[model samples]
Target chain A: MSRQNFEEQLDGLHRQLMSMGTLVEEAIHKAIKSLVERDRELAMEVMKNDQLINQMEHEIESGCFRTIALQQPVGGDLRRLGTMLKIVTDLERMGDHAVAIAKTTTRLMAEPYVKPLIDIPLMADHVKAMVRDSLNAYIAKDDQAAGRIAAQDDVVDKLYAKIFRDLIEVMSKQEHTINQGTHLLLVAQYLERIADHVTNICEWVIYMTSGQKTDLNK
Target chain B: MSRQNFEEQLDGLHRQLMSMGTLVEEAIHKAIKSLVERDRELAMEVMKNDQLINQMEHEIESGCFRTIALQQPVGGDLRRLGTMLKIVTDLERMGDHAVAIAKTTTRLMAEPYVKPLIDIPLMADHVKAMVRDSLNAYIAKDDQAAGRIAAQDDVVDKLYAKIFRDLIEVMSKQEHTINQGTHLLLVAQYLERIADHVTNICEWVIYMTSGQKTDLNK
Candidate 1:
C-alpha cells in the first residue's frame, strides 16, 4: 500500500475503534441505569449488545493483523497498530464486564432493595467519562489530555473507598439489605475497574507517542 | 543477531515471562491469604512486591522490542513475542489489582467483622488455579488445557453470584454489617477480575498458537 493509503487506513481503523468505544460507553451507562432503575428489559438489551462488541473486537484484531502482514508497518506506525490491538481487547473486556453487571442486575431484579443507588451510578458516570476521554486522547494523540483524564481515576478510587465504608455500615446495621448491598458493591467495583482499564489505555497512548512509558495514574 | 543466538534470547525471554507469571500468581495468592488471615504484615509485604511486578512488565516489554528489532522474527516466533507483549500487560494489571486489594485489606485491619470469611478465600483459590493452569498451558503449548481452564471461569462467576447473595442477606438482616460486607464484596470482585485477566492471557496464548480467536468464557 502507498503511504497515503496506509495513513488513510490507519485513520479508518482509529475511527472504527472510537466507534466501538462509544458503543461500549453507552452499554456501560445503560447497564448501570438498568440496574439502578430495576429495568430488566434494558439489562437484557445490554446482554444482547454484547455480541456486537465481541464481533467488533474480532474485526479490529483482524484489521491489526492485516495491517501488520500486508502493510508491514514499522516504527511508530507499528507501535500504533500494536497499541490499538491491545486497546480494543481492553475495550472488549470492559464491555463484557458491563454485560456481567447487567446480568447481575437482572438477578437482583427479584431481590429487595438495600441502599440508595447513589455511589454506584456516580462511579459509572466517571468511568464513562474516562472511556470517552481516553478514546479522544487516542484519536487526537493528546498526551496532556490523556494524562489529566488518567489522574482523575483517583476520584473513582476514593468513591470506591467511600462506598465500601457506607455499604459496610448498612450491612452491619440491617440484615435485610445484605444481599442487595453485596450486588451493588460488585457493580461499583466493576465500574471502578472499567475506569482503571481506561487509564491503562491512556498510558499506552502516551507510550506510543513519546516512546517513554509513563504512569498516568500519577 | 545470529538465528541461534536469537532463539536463545527468545527462549530466555519466554522463561522470564513465565517466571514473572509465577511471581504474580504468588503475589495474588499471598495477597488473598493476607486478607483472609488478616495478616497485616503480609499485606504490607505484598504491597512492597508491586515494584517487582512493575519492573518485570517493563523489562519483558523491552525484551519483546529488542527481539523483534534484532531478529526480525517471523511467523510463530513473531506471534509469540507479540502475544507475550499483551499477556505481560494483563499480568501486570492483575498484579496491580492484587496490590489494590492488599491496600484495602490493610485499611480494614482495625475494623470489626460482619461475617467470617468463606467465599472470598474460595474465590481466590479458584482464581489461583486458573492462573496456574493458564500459564501452564502457555508454557506447555496446550491449547486444549487453556481452553478448558478458560471455560472454568464460570466457576468463579457462579461463586461470585453465591457470595453476592450471601453477603446481601447479611446486610439486609443486620445494618451494622454493611461496612464489613462491602469490603468482602470488594475482595470477591477483585478475585473475580484476576480470574478474568487470567482468562485473557490464556485466550492470547490460544490465539498465538492457533491464529484463531476464541471465547473462553463460552
Candidate 2:
C-alpha cells in the first residue's frame, strides 16, 4: 500500500475511535442523569448502548490488526496505532463503568436519594472534559496539553475524597442511608476511575509524541 | 531476522508478560493477606511494590513497540503482540487495585473486625486463581479454557454481593463499624474488579486465538 492510503486508513481508524469516545461520553452523561433525575429508562438505555461502544471498539481493533499486518507500521505510525488501541480499551471500560453506574441507579430508584448528587455530577463533568481534552491532545500530538489534561485528574480525585467523607458521615448518622449512600459512593468512585482513565489516555498521548514514559497520575 | 529469531523474540516477550502476571498475582495475594491478617506492614509492602509492577509493565510495553517497529510482525504473530500488550495493561491495573486494597487495609487496621472476613478472602482466592488460569489459558492458546476462566468471574461477583449485603447489615446494626465496614466493602470491590480484569485477559486470549470479539463480562 502507498503511504497516502496508509495515512487515510489510519485516519479512518482514528475517526472510529473518536466515535467510540463519543459513545462513552454519552454513556457517562446519561448514567449520571439517570441517577440525578431518577430516570430508570435512561439508565437502561446507557446499559444497552454499551454493547454498541464495545462493537465499535472491537471493529476498530480488528482493523488496526489488519492494517498492522499488511503495512507493518513503524515509528510514529506504529505508536499512533498502539496508542489508539490502548485508548479504545480505556474508552470501552469507561463505558462499562457507566453501565455499572446506571445499574446502580436502577437499583436505587425505589429509595429516595440520601443527599443531592451535586458533587457526583460535578466530578462527572470534570471527567467528561478530561476525556475530550485527552483525545484532543492525542490528535494534536501536544505533549504539554496532555500533561495539563492529566493534572486535571487531581481535581476529580479531591472531589471523590470529599464525597466519600460526606457519605461516611451521612451513613454513620442515619443508618437507613447506609445502603443508598454506599451506592452513591460507588458512582463517584466510577467517575473518579473514568477520569483516571482519561489521564491514562493522556499519558499515552505524551508517550506516543515524545517517546518518554511519564506517570501523570503522580 | 529469520523466522526462528522472530519466534524467539516473541517467546522472550511472552516470558516477560508471564513475569508481570506473577508479580500481579503476588500483589493480589499479599494485599488480601494483609487485610485478612490485619498486617499493616504487608499492606504497605504491597503498596510499595506497585511501582515495580508499573516499571516492569512500561519496560515490556516499550520492548513491544521496539520489536514491532524493527521486526514488523505479521499475521498471527502481530495479534499475539497485540494480545500481550492488552494483557500487560490488565495485569498492571490489577496491581493498582491490589495497592488500593492494601491502602484500605492500612486505613482500617485500628478498627475491630466487623465479621470474620470469610467471604472476602474467599473472593480473593478466586480472583488469584483466575489471574493464574487466565495466563495459563493465554499461554496455551486454549480459547475454551479462556472462556471457562471468564465464566468463573461469576463466583467473584456473587461473593462480592454477599459481602456487600453482609457489610450493609453490620453497618446498619452498629454505627461505629460503618467506616471500617465500608472500607471492607471497597476491598471486596477491588477483588471483584481484579477478577473482572482476569476475565479481560481471557477475552483477549479468545480474541488472539479465534479473532472473534467476545464479551466475557456478560
Candidate 3:
C-alpha cells in the first residue's frame, strides 16, 4: 500500500532470496562432499531436500507477482523484482545440478572411484564461491562485483577441460574404467553448468543496475 | 494506456516471443541436422547464428522493461510481461544447448560411425516437437495443453536413458570409440536438457494463466 511498506516487502524479498541462495550453496557443498567422501546418506539427504529449494523458488516467485500487482512498482523497484525472478531460477537450477551431482554420487557408491576426484571437488568449491559472490553482488547491487565474479567461470571451465582430458585418458587405457569415468565426467559437466548459472546471475545484476544486456559467460 | 492498448502490446510481445522460440527451434533442428548428416558447415552455421538468438532475447527483454516502465502494467498484464521475460531466458538457454550440441558435432566430426544413430535423431525430433508444442500451448493460454506437452518430457527422458545405456555399452566394448561415444552421449544429454527447458515454458504458461506455480517437469 504505502511506499514504505513496499520497500519493506522488497527488502524482505531480498532476504528470502539470499536465504534461497544459501540453501543452494549448501546443497552444492553437501552434494560434492558426499561425492568426495562416498557418503550415500548425505547424497540422499541432498536429493530429498531439493524439494525445499523448489518450494522457496515458487514462494519467491509468488511474492514477486504480488508485489507487482499491489504496488505497481516502477523503474528501479520494478527491475529489482523482475531480476530476482531470474536470479532465483538460476539458483534453483544450481540446486538441481547439485541434486544431480548427489544422484551421481549415489549411483557410483558401490564402484571404486576411477580417480581421486581432486579436480572435481576443487571445481565444486570454486563454483560454490561463485554462487556466494554472485548473491553478494546482487544484495549489494554491485555491478563491478558481479563482473569480477563472472570472470571466475573461466577457472571452472579450465578445470572441466582438465577433468575431461584426464577421464578420456583413463577410459582409453583401462577399459574397465569407462563406465565410472563417464559418470565422473558428467559430474564435472554438472559443476561447469552451475558455474554458467552463476554467470547468468552476474549478467542479471549488470542488467538490473545499468540496463545493459551483456553475456558475462561469453 | 487503455486496456485495448495494453492488449495490443501484449500481442506484440507474444508474437516476438514466438519468433524467438522459432529461432531456437530452428537452431535445434539445424544443429541436430548437422550432427546426423555430419555436415560441418551446417554445424558451424548453427554456432555462428547463436548470436542472433542472443540479440533477439535482449531486444524482447528491453521491450518488456520499456512496456513496464511506461505503461505500469498491473495484475495479469504485469505477470504476463514477467512471465515472458522468464520464457525468453528459457528459450535462449535452449538455444545455448543447441549450440553446445553443434560444438559436440564439430568435436566428433573426424570420428567414424558410432552405431547407426537412429535413437539420437529420434530423441531430437521428439524434443523439437516439445519445443513447438510448448510455444503453441503458451500462445493459446491452454493450461491443459501446457500440462499435456509437459508430460511428453517423460518420453525424452526415457530416450536419453536408452542412449546413455547404449553408449556406455559401445564405449565399454571398444576403446577408440570412447571419445566419440562420450560426445554422442553429451549430445543426447543436451537434447534432454532442451526438453527440460520446454517443460519450463509449459510451467510458465500454466502459471501465466492460473497465477499458480507448478513444476511440470516433476
Candidate 4:
C-alpha cells in the first residue's frame, strides 16, 4: 500500500471510530434518561442499539487488522492503529455498561425510586463529557487534553462513592428500598465504570501521541 | 525475522501470557479467600499483585505489537496475535475485578458473617475454573473447549443471580446487614464479570481458530 493510501485508510477508520463513539455516548445518555424517566421503551432501545455498536466494533477491528496486514505500519502509524483497536474495545465495553444500566432501569420500573435521581445523572453527564473529550484528544493527538480528561475520573469516582453511601443509608432505613437501592447502586457503578473506560481511552490517547504509558486510572 | 525466529517469538509471548494467566487465577483465588476468611493480609497481597498483572499486560502487549510490526504476519498468524492482544485485555480485566473484590474485603472488615459466604466462594471457584479452562483452550487452539468454557458462564450467572437475591433478602430483613450485604453483592458481581471476561476469551479463541466471530457472551 502506498503511504497516502494507508493514511486515507487510517482516516476512514478514525471516522468510523468517531461514529462508534457517538453511538456509545448516545447509549449512555439514553440509558440514564430511561432510568430517570422510567421509560421502559427507551431502555429497550438502548439495549437493542448496543448490537449496532458491537457490530461497528467488529467492522472497525477487521479494518484495523486488514490495514496492518497490508500496510505493515510501524512506529507512530502502528501505534495509532493499535490505539484504535484498544479504544474500540473500551468503547464497546462502555456500550455494554450502558446496556447494564438500561437493564437496571427495566428492573426498577415496577416501583418508585427511593430517592430522586440527581447524582447518578450528574455522574453520567461528567462521564459523557469525558468520553467526548477523550475522543477529541484522540483525533487531535493531544496528550495534554487526554491528561485533563483522565483527571476527571476522580470526580466520577467521588460521585459514585456518594451515591453508594446515600443508597446504603436509604436501604438501611427502609426495608422496601433495598431491592431498588442496590440496583441503583449498580447503575452508579456502571456509570463509574464507563468513566473508567474513558480514562483508559485517555491513557491510550497519551500513549499513542507520546509513546508513554501513563496510569491515569489511579 | 525468519519464520523460525518469528515462531519462537510467538511461543515466548504465549508463555508470558500463560504466566500472566496463572497470576490472574491466583489473584482470584486469594481475593476470594481473603473475603471468605476475612484475611486482610491476603486481600492486601491480591491488591499488590494486581500491579504485577498490569505490568505484565503492558509488556506482553508491547511484545505483540513489535512482533506484528516486524513479521507482517497475515491470515491465521495475524489472527492468533490479535487474539493474544484481546485475551490479555480480558485477563487484565479479570485481575481488576479481583482487586475490586479485595477492596470490598477491606471495606467490610468491620463486619461479621453475612450468611457465611458459601455461594460467593463457590461462584469464585467456578469463574477461576473458567479462566483456567479458557487459557487452556487458547493454548491448545481447542475451539470446542472454548465453547464449553463459554457455556460455564451461564453457571456463573445463575450463581450470581442467586447470590443477589439471597443478599437482598438478608439485608431487607436485617438493617445491620445492609452495608455488608451490599458489599457482598458487589463481590458476587465482580465474580460474575470475571466470568463474562472469560467468556470473551472463549469467543476470541473460537475466532482465532475458525476465523469466525461468534458471540459466546450471549
Q: Which regions of candidate 3 fall more than 4 Å away from where they truly are?
A: none
List the per-model TM-score of the A chain: 0.96, 0.98, 0.98, 0.98
Candidate 2 scores a chain A TM-score of 0.98
Worst 10 residues of 1 chain A by lDDT: A171-180
Ranking by TM-score: 4, 2, 3, 1
- Please, what are the lDDT tens digits per residue for candidate 1 over residues A30-117? 9999988999999999999989998898888778767666676777887788788879978998998899799888889887676568
Please estimate how well model 3 matches the true structure, expressed as its whole-model Cα lDDT: 0.90
Per-residue C-alpha lDDT of model 3 across residues A124-203, encoded as one tens digit per residue: 98999999999999989999999999999999999999999999999999999988999999999999999999999999
- Lowest summed lDDT across 10 adjacent residues in model 3 chain B is found at B108-117
**Model 4: per-residue lDDT, tens digit, B51-152?**
999999999989999999999899899999999989998999899999999999898888788568799989999998899999999999999999988998
Query: Could you give the CAPRI-style class of model 2?
Result: high
Task: Give the Cα lDDT of each candidate.
Answer: 0.82, 0.90, 0.90, 0.93
lDDT of 4 by residue, A84-107 (tens): 989999999999999999999899
What TM-score fits each model?
A: 0.91, 0.98, 0.97, 0.99
lDDT of 2 by residue, A1-218 (tens): 99999989988997888788888999999999999999999999998999899999999988888888788888889898998889899999999999999999999988888667899999999999898889888888899999988988889999999999999999999999999999999999999899989989998999899888787876
Q: Regarding TM-score, does 2 or 3 come out ahead?
A: 2
TM-score of 1: 0.91
Best-first order by DockQ:
2, 4, 3, 1
Task: Candidate 1: list runs displaced more than 4 Å.
Answer: A111-119, B111-119, B169-175
Count of backbone clashes, every candidate in sequence: 29, 0, 0, 0
Docking outcome class, model 1 = acceptable
